[model samples]
Target: MAIGGVTIFATLGYFALYSNKKPEASAKDVAKVTAGVAKPGNTRPR
Candidate 1:
């Protein structure tokens, strides 16, 4: 049980330190992604 607790804590700490560290997307990158998703047959009616 103690080992399990340590493992959980370590996992949480790793993510806490590393997660959400990505650089913010630039407008060009956003537009490229949007364009890919908007290509033919990719759209679904909402």
Candidate 2:
């Protein structure tokens, strides 16, 4: 039971650190996606 608790905490700590250190998506990429809405064709997804 102690081993399982440690494993769970370790996984949670790893994700916490990973998320804090993760890179954000670039503005260009964000703009590209936003610009897709302006296209003349049907915008609604099937």
Candidate 3:
């Protein structure tokens, strides 16, 4: 039971660390795509 509890805490800690690191490249890509589609040429939101 003690080992299982430690494993769960370790897993949670790993995810906590992972979530803190945001992907800046993906954000830039999304902004580029949004800017392109938001232009007057493309009125429909995809």
Highest TM-score against the true fold, candidate: 2
- For each candidate, the alpha-carbon lDDT, in order, equals 0.47, 0.47, 0.49
Pitting candidate 2 against candidate 3, the one with the higher TM-score is: 2
Tens digits of lDDT, candidate 1, 1-46: 9999988876665455344333453433433334444443323222
What's the lDDT for residue 1 in model 2?
A: 100
TM-score for every candidate vs. truth? 0.42, 0.46, 0.46
- Pairs with steric clashes in candidate 3: none
Q: lDDT per residue, candidate 3, 1-24, as tens digits? A: 999998887666555544554454
Selected candidate, larger TM-score, 1 vs 2: 2
TM-score of 2: 0.46
Tell me the tens digit of each residue's lDDT in model 2 across 1-46: 9999988876665555445441553333333344443332332232
Clashes of 2: 0
From the highest lDDT down, the ranking of the candidates is 3, 2, 1
Cα error, residue 3 of model 1, in Å, equals 0.1
Residue 46 miss distance in model 3 (angstroms)? 36
RMSD in Å for model 3: 13.2
